[model samples]
Target: MQTYARRLALVLAFTLLPLSGCKRTHQIIHHATSSEPDYTPQILADITPGHIDGMKYPDFTDIQAQVNNLYDMRDVDALWVKGGKPTAQADAMLQEFSNAMQRGLRPEDYDASRWDERVANLKSPEGAALFDVALTVNAIRYLNDLHEGRTNPAHFTFGVKGYNEKKIDAVTILNTQIIDASDVTAAVDAAEPQSLQYKALKKGLKQYLDLVPQDHSDPLPEMNPNAKSIAITAGYPALQSLQQKLTLLGDYSGDANATASSADLTEALKHFQHRHGLNEDGKLGSATIDALNTPLTARVTQIVDTMERWRWLNDDYQNAAIIVNLPEFELRAFEGTGNDHHEVFRMNVVDGKSDDDTHHTPVIADQMKYLVFRPYWNVPPSIARKEIIPHMQKQPGYLGAKNYETVDLKGNVVSPNIAAIDKGTQMVRQKAGTSNSLGLVKFMFPNPFNVYLHDTNEKALFTRTRRDYSHGCVRLQDPPKMANWLLRDNSKWDEDSIADAMNDGQDNKTVLLPKPIPVVVFYGTAWSDDGEMHFFRDMYGYDDDLEKTLNGGRPYPQKPMKAVTEKDA
Candidate 1:
């Protein structure tokens, strides 16, 4: 009877053992897949504490801190895996990586080519964890590049200032921006700049990239520099090629039967010239021919470079600001917010000449605090020593005839002395008048370069396509309009009152603004507006410098100015 009881006890213990095992297995599964708050132990157990340290990936070393912190927050769980397979979010992010070139980035720079292999390596749990970390690292890098730019602005010698780098935490981006989002693509797209100008440039970049493959194989014939032009005439060999090129650029809408220098061809050439920052004369001059021969691939590169520059611009300009694009010779004042924000005013501007790089405008961002009506042109020391002093010596009474006055170092009125001027102890100033270099009104932003926006005595310069005539200051075509817009907030200032202040014969009258307006003097060679891409001349060779820098060449340091020789003086 005792032996029979022992057998029954053994059977009961064995039966209950399987039931207990099943209960523990169910709990583990629940913990792994649960939506509860305290379900991290199983996930945490999957990642060993020293696994990240043991990894041999060098590409991810730069982002090691972010990756380490991200894993620690989740107790070292695999972020891109669930149920032993890659999650849908991981796949979506990989796809976005594959399309990085759409944002002016090289996909290979982000290891996009290795994505398929990385995804396939997810079969093993260890492989899954490492792949997850890599995806997170690359995603963070991609977002950063899209937000700020691949190259730092300081790499170029543009005197760029006020660039605020966007700081983002990898874990936060994963949890908030990606994890619960229904549309992963849209979530990722939010990383790019929000400016409408950037979007337009991005669209333009895509279009130009598509055109690169269709570039013409025919080499365009060179033009004779002394020849007047190649115009409407029969039997011109280059005409058909020109027509074909214009057609490829969408500038020529005429059919294949259209001949060169025909009315249709002339109009198309004019359009092309307009787009390329040339005079639209419809004649094939050397400049026009050279521009026409610029390969589509080169234009694609220009579009890419422009897009890169757009990334460096400030994301916010304090709700209202003025932007002067030096290459385009235009100033735009923008206001409002988001979709409502746009250019309230746009006008032609004359920027500094790039003559031997002496008068090239310095790119900077600052605030305009006041307007000086009938302001004096305080001659720069270099200009005074080099240009004015010699002229005064050669032509007696030249300063008085030009409305210029002599000023001691203390700014007190003094008699013009040739020896004092030659010694550089005294300065010169042009009194406010119609002939004053600063014209009627001057806008002051107070930069180190001593550059400002003002009316020009030489208004005819604005009519030229390339107006780089100033000595580092911007010349406004319509100073009255700018003053009226700037002082609109002050009830005392209206259009009529502003005009009176400008023309009231009150010399050097200064009026402080109610609020300071931000001013950004920038250089961009290409931009898009109204669904059309516009290209401009790299007036200062800045584009060439930037291109070399972007292509891994060292940026050339600016040369120091040569001392003025006796002859020059």
Candidate 2:
């Protein structure tokens, strides 16, 4: 029992159940020609307090109650074992465990290859009981990992709110989906997101894995950090290495020894840059060099990490949803089911600066409640204290010069004196106009992050490839277009009215939408579009943080397996 328990903990950092059933001794029933053994007592004893049950409190309790509930409903009979052997459902689950990598999971985490030996050595009823318990533990863990990510998003405090599932549902799903299914693998796959975006990433995983070479020790030539750009002239020093790397990465199909003037090589460089969210100027710049230096295996890990984050999402953003891919600095609005979700419209966006801790655009799952047109930019207290107040103190007339005001707590405009602004007794707000910091419009949502999507006065910032210049709020490229889409349920507001409201002289006009449009400020450095995988720079170092948090515990053991002999069996 302790051996199986240790194996589970070494694999995924969690396991075991506190089952809710009987202490009745193992029973066997015989008919005229057949007999089936009841291993319920064996199951209960295997997951007992100090044996295979090494998980902590509630998690242990929930799974235990659920598994016990399964046997309780079956008159304390084991669900995965029949006649002292694993049932067909158990075999189906073993296949799911073996193909776990296909879904961006590690097969070893589920004891994939090790299962066969475990089953072959299950020559005794007690061994069969342990095997059954281990199977249940792995199955539940796989389902949870595939549904809600292996690494906890809360570990990094990204503010990504996820839907929590009760542990009891773990066995409920197994009973219905696995135990009563013809295609067990299909049932297991159905546990994940059923969206096209998820499917694209999943398919791209295989394609990207195929691009990895037998060995990746030989990397491209190190580029000069100070060099602005390297021209691909004839016999360029890094040209051969560049061509070989890109060719192996599937961005270049021609020969590695192709000339520097080879259009294929140039186009391949541009294509690689495009996929990597880099400036595709068809030149070897330092940024491009950094991306090229990133190992293919690293990119594969990024894809898997992206897949894990996708599992954190529920059905909220699937229909009539707005998604802001933080790494890409892009937004996509969609309104339909996965099969016909073609109503998606995309636009470039400017998110918060990644360099500052407080300036990151928080990852959130919420709803856009309304639109505020020609809105007043109520400056935050931190900004006022750090930036505006200092400027106001230096230039006494700076307040009136920019149509900014000092407003008291009672929602009344106060005297624009520098004394009150310096004292922090009053808040600051920029008047609604063309020169306002928020430009002409803002979308409001109910979130604790105090962030929103809005029009920005710094429109020129959008033209840059890496736009992260805001103070945590997201800046939209086309707020009027977003307004029109949000107001589609209302007949009074068209694109013309939307444009008029944003451009008019009206100060802070609010328009409540008919319904809440689900919005998610999501962060994924790797994404898939049109069946092509795309990678982006980790703007806020979240990828590194998530990776570290995931690897912070004991790693899986890589011990060789000795086949079970007849004597061992």
Candidate 3:
């Protein structure tokens, strides 16, 4: 697009400058067109690349187009310099740069530590111009990282499809919102995600960063290899260490040195288990010890990484949507927007099994358009071929026992003969009834993943601590609750109507919602909610992928596999 981006360049010229004007040359001198920016405010003359700028800034390579447009809007004149000194706005921005860690950003990445020296060295017009240019570059970089993220979400491969949603122009926010705002800090703050979830993580990050350990504590004793649970007998070696950890985490409030009462120890252990994604049985098992041994700083890093993923979500959807956090096996429906958004409801969910390739739930976002009542269970061909057909071949009465039958491509009923099923000429489907695999209702959404939220016949699975037993689709613990809330605005449907539709031996039917609700299947190993921090099992090593990418540094791999669209075809 443009030539080489303006970088930090050295210069020697005028020593001091006036605060107001360097000399404003009016272009189209009298009445300006709508598109032209006011040249009257641009104080310094067009800066020469290296002759006007410093070592604090490198070439503005990452944000090429937006940076060009920002500079061009003011006709290459100095926007940061008024007289010879950095403006109050520049100071406000510089202060924010130093405090970037609170926003899960590295201050040094934006030249936070280097700004004061650069500002103090501004002696001539050359120095002033370079200072102005360097500030522009760093400010843009900081805002871009804060608004979207340091790296793109497409790099993490968390979603079924790369969730590289369109990013907002930080340059526009800088030009319009931050530059002349009465409150610069608030304006810069406004650039970040305003959702409650993001705020919770940020709060936790600040709290943990403040307490990040300088040195490691003595390691907890390893559990016996075959032991199922740690014994809580008096004077146990691991008990004291566990107590210390529990106290640090706010789980155990009593004496860290004293041997705790059996009941108190169990309760604290349960609290720790709940915060982590483990069975809240209060037993100090190996998994719990593993979670306990995890350093506080590691948790902070985990949170920072999760915050980066939040930037990938669609802004509108982030505020109000049904979000399923895979690792937590929970879905929360949030309503409203900004920090004021409240969780409408939440329910435990059964996500896909992770022990195999075909069953892992894919992360994605889409509109849940309708609900199907008494939906027939159209068994996927893979499942049919691997499990169903083989079972039926051995047990001739398996089809009848399981309420399954064969169907042709045209939706006509056919014999459950082995030949047709083996030849792939016919597909298997369970009848629409209470005993159907898809429980009594089906919530449909459009995505390439071919997954949906639905009621499941095996409701008992919800009782288990680990509920990843489904085949890619999400199984709701409380389908009736989900239906009632989702259909609250539809006059014809109430709790009774929804219950009636889900039962009564009716044929499979679908109800299109009056308005669609956003549904997002998400994966985050660490989350903060209600002023409490949560850490979950990696479940799918997504955390590993993200941590690797973050450590590998810049030019983050975006879209490891390109998304196909009609434009490409």
Error of 2 at 72 (Å): 2.2
Model 3 per-residue lDDT tens digits across residues 36-119: 223333223433232223444465666655655676675555567665577788888888888888998777767788777777
Estimate the TM-score for candidate 3: 0.82
Number of clashing residue pairs, candidate 2? 2
lDDT of 3 at 226: 74
lDDT measured at residue 239 in model 1 versus the true structure, 0 to 100: 70
Candidate 1 ranges with C-alpha deviation above 4 Å: 1-63, 81-86, 123-130, 159-161, 165-171, 256-261, 318-320, 392-398, 415-425, 553-569
Q: Pick the candidate with the highest TM-score.
A: 2
- Per-residue lDDT, model 2, residue 94, is 87
Worst 10 residues of 1 by lDDT: 560-569
Which structure is stronger by TM-score: 2 or 3? 2
**What is the per-residue lDDT of model 1 for residues 452-480, given as tens digits with 9 covering 90 to 100?**
89998898988998888888889999999
The 10 consecutive residues of candidate 3 with the worst lDDT sum are 5-14
Each prediction's whole-model lDDT (CA): 0.73, 0.73, 0.73
lDDT of 1: 0.73
